[model samples]
Target: MASPLITLRENTIWENKHGTVSITPRSLCDVWNTWVGPGVSNGPIWRPGLAGLRALVAQAEAQNQRIRGLGGAWSLSPAAATHGIMVNTKPLNYIELGFRDASLDTAFSGNPDALCFAQCGASVLELYQYLEVRGYTLPTSGASNGQTIAGAVSTGTHGSAHSIGSMQDYILGLHMVIDGGRHCWIERASKPVVSPSFCQAIGAELLRDDALFNAAVVSFGSFGLMHAVLFEAEPLFLLEKSLVRMDYARVQAALGTLDVEALDLSGGRELPFHFEVVVNPYRVSRGQRGAYVRYMYKRPYRPTQASAGGSTWVQGDDVMTMLGTVTGWTPHLVPVLLEPILSAQLAPVQGVAGTPGFQFGAADLRGYVMSSEIGVALADAPNAIDAVIDVANRFHWSGFPAIRYVKGSDATLAFTNFSPTACTIELPSAGSPRTLEAFHRVWDELRARGIRFTMHWGQMMRENREWIEYGHGARVEEWLAARQSLLGATGQRAFGSDWLTACGLG
Candidate 1:
């Protein structure tokens, strides 16, 4: 079979918002042939199908070369970098729907209409459109729609859905090309979905293990390159969104207990589908100040003659761009300058109703942006927020903080691993040394206070061996054991990178 046309650029300078890399892909292969390369070859390859991906992994293992997959390049961290071959999975995108048959096992009793197989490179926006047309919708998604399905789940990207968990929670199955040319489809043994025949048709060995499945869901490319994912989607629905300004006390009440009814929201006693609070640390010091809050409720889908609102399609300007304009104007005056900017950015308490696809549309990438996020137990949200505000005030930092909640995820390494509910506190700011220092201080203070927290895998974090050990504890050992079981010592060495090594995962 003919190979896909592959392109290679040598000594290329890859720069994202946070870091820069002088990547050197010694040799490049753009082909979909599983057996294209001979044993002991160091050539880089771009595989467009499952067979080709497996072949490339086998070749990398044979040649003792490290490999990594790149998708969208939206991550601020360097987890995707490799010292050897880099496989660009952008061209391998493919999507399909699952079907039901009598041959299926009785354990496979899920709604067949809700099953979807999305290839590694398929972006979230693309999947949204595809599912929307079929009267299906993703249960939850990140604020931005540009991230690929595999990348989003692998890095534990999440939304502010108080009920729904992170993206990894909805994943029913994972199709992966592991080291030594092994291809397998993994799912929970307790709740098996796909039949053996379906796995065989896709040329995969079936493995129904709960721990292995949970570990691989958020492996961050360490469990080998994921070829595709099987997602369980929900029926299409509308979201009624309202953005309002509330007093700090009211916002604190909601964050403290997550009891929306206590706050006297419009939908009394009914939990909101999505809730978020954006706060200005400087303003929080004033007893009378308020924060911007957004609430979204799920509604049954209905046909309407009216077109979607303009605001729904256009996601306004990037917050990073707005903050960048005032950079270097005056560090101390940042709070004052940001007040009006934030108001303008989050103004007009208008109501909007639309499908999830239109509501959380594509994200616009702007100049350098860096963010740090940590997940803490919901009961500790009040103290955590206060500590963060203290750190911001003490350092006079220009960045602002926001809090979003999500149900705890089952993924072993997910930052939202806190049981019951977890609140993710995010600090996004213009990339600067001062901002980085402030971020580090926040972590240091939280650690000193004995506050147990986990950092987002895809965001900028002050991660070290001790931090990982302290945050994850026994789960860290379980994840490492699962990794060892899936990818043996040689495979781990071939797929691991410096970031993984620094965190003691490699």
Candidate 2:
């Protein structure tokens, strides 16, 4: 059999909006591979398949070179960058459906009908399209569908479903290529999935351990190269959405408890499938108050004419990108100029129904945006919001703060580890120096007040090791220990980046 095609580029300059990385060499490969094909080398060779991927890891080990996986490059932080070799995984998009007794372990009780095996490079949109064709859909996804599955899960990307947690929460297993060319398939010991044959077919050694699994789920590429992931998707469903403008008090009440009755939503008193609140800090006065709220309720999936909804869904990128442009032109007049934009953009309160993919369409800000998101306990939401609002008012921040809630995530390193639920305070704006400075000040104040909070790994944040320890506490220690035990010193060096070292995770 022939080895999979692989390409190497030298002295490449890879850059995103927030950071730039100069790679000495970069490797790109496809996802097709035949393990027993012709010209099999004594040592591993660089290819897209499991064997080829392991070969790259072996080469990195042999050369004492660091390796990092590059996906959609959607992160606002430099967590994915490295001075050493970069492996481009975008070409390795592949998706597979699992069946009952697919794992070598017969005791596996996972619902094979819900299982989806997605290669690391598959974009969120690709997965959604694939599942939609099979009469299934992801339970939750971020506001956008452009991120790679591995990148989103690794960074703990989340949606605003108050009942559902972040992306990592749905993942059941991981296929990782660790140091020394070891390929391991990991799943939680408490809830095992896949049979031994499944592991063998993928050329992986099965290991069932909860701690190790949780650590790797949101390891941010420190654990190893996440070649693929096995997640439990759900039957296709539609979401009925409504956008309304409410006062600060009403919005605060809903954020604190997610009580549908208190907010008086049009969809009766039941809890919503998804909820989010956007607040304009400058218009907080009673008469001028403005809070744009979105509520989505789940509906049973039904095959309908494609023209029923008439493509009413709109991508968030157009609005956000326009906001970026407007803020860039007149940063000083943001408070005076932003009120009408918010009112005009969020005035519609009618019901519109669509699939999860259509509801949360591709949100690409086109590299003109900067954001900072912090997660706090649901009960502490009001205080956190007030604190942030106070700072924004004082500094005249250009960006408005939005609040979205999600059930706590099970990933060990997830920022939304708060019990019950977490309220995410997200501030997005054009990449302005003043906005960035104000965001830092908010972080400082939150820390000084001892307000329990955790920062999103994929967003702009203060890279302070002490703050990480303070926020995550013992969980950070456990995550670090898991990394050390699994990756050891060699794997650490190979996957470590300056950002990881700064966070004390390297």
Candidate 3:
């Protein structure tokens, strides 16, 4: 890795509407991405990869003894940073859309339980497009799919649904570079340890402890380098997504009973395949639904000319769109810039009713542009929402909306990681400093009140110093103890990163 200001310019994020946004690097050392995790210089920075990355890390290990790999810049927290060598694995992006067995059976075949061998840098959107080709889908996903599979699972990226778990829940196994970079494969504990031959086939020494394995599955970047992930996906089906404005009063009445009881607008109600609740701070006086809620119903796949018909392009676009939204322009303006364009993207929106593979909440991935600055999660859905409204009433920062909804998650870092016991209360906005200040005031008030809510590892929520203390709290200790136990010494140092220190996770 070299050092040169001019070379570093390549890694900067291109804020302009048209032009390349690449990481600036004088040499390999400066290479990084759009993500800024702990101690990282603000903005995009390119990182050298392949031998260059390993060489840097090796040198660090010989000296400072700390180096870590970073997946997607999806994390708003510092979990991806490192004082030593930081390998930007984002370029390792690739999705091998194939299967292994839903039963964890090595022999079975035939789209066996919709599965994919996702690389360390493969984005969720990319994985989705790969699955679409084969007519398969994952059980769930986060609001958007910009995060890499490795980052999403490691950080416990969550979607709205409690019945299922976080990104880790669907992850059936892992392929990682271990001590001295020994590639290892981990799966749900097996009866006989995957057989010596099979273990060698995938290049790993098998381990079978439920506690350690589970903890490490969602271990964030603190775990060793993740090269690939084996996730269990669902059958290919269409998700009939529909958005409706919700009534604040009715929502208040149905808050507790809503998600838990199901029975949305489709009669006495039942949970849709997917759900989303968007709160508008400016809507207090407006007569729109309390919050815009969307529901998705599952259906069999059927392709047409209008549909991409099992193409990778859909997911590819979704990835770029996810990244673009973070810049804070209305996603609704997609037609203005991208509607007529044809290019590679994971999740596609080409004015088609539905694609052959499937669909989920907020089908219009393009219409949801949002800024990356504000991210906050309030614990106890009902309590969090009330507190938000109360604060808004007091400060008149009602223009910003507090999005609500539930998603299934079991990731150690997911805000709603615990079921029944967890529900997310997020505050999202594309606004001015005054409105943002109002948000902070309320967030601080709730923190003082001791409301536990896990913040999204990606998106906003990265600035809260006491985030883990308030969100993970007791569970944090349990996970830390469990993680320490799982990633024992000899290899623990390699797994440790600045990300942990930033979140007070070490």
Query: How close is every model to the real structure, measured as TM-score?
Result: 0.91, 0.92, 0.72
Q: Which residue runs of candidate 1 sit more than 4 Å off their true CA positions?
A: 17-48, 102-104, 285-288, 304-335
lDDT of 2 at 77: 75
Please give, for residues 57-115, the per-residue lDDT of candidate 3 as tens digits.
34554564665666655554455655444566666665655443333455433344455
Best by lDDT: 2
Q: What is the lDDT of residue 346 in candidate 1?
A: 69
Clashes of each: 0, 10, 52
TM-score of candidate 2 versus the correct structure, residues matched by position = 0.92
Better of 1 and 2 by lDDT: 2
Q: What residue runs in model 3 are displaced by over 4 Å at the alpha carbon?
A: 1-57, 97-113, 190-196, 259-268, 285-288, 304-379, 396-408, 431-439, 448-450, 462-467, 486-499
Question: Candidate 3: deviation at residue 484, Å?
Answer: 2.9
Q: List model 1 lDDT by residue over 1-506, tens digit each.
A: 44434456555555543442334554443433233333423322323366667767887888888877777677777767776667777666677665577425577777886889888887888888888778888899887677789888998988899688999999999998888878899889987888888777666899899999999999988999888899878988988877777667767877878877766567776778988888878786446455877778898987632212222324322344455555546545565676777777767455577787767775556545577889999988888888898898898777887788999988999999888898999887766778889889999888888888889988888658789777777899899888888888878987898788988888
* Candidate 2, residue 132: how far the Cα is off, in Å: 0.8
lDDT of each: 0.76, 0.77, 0.52
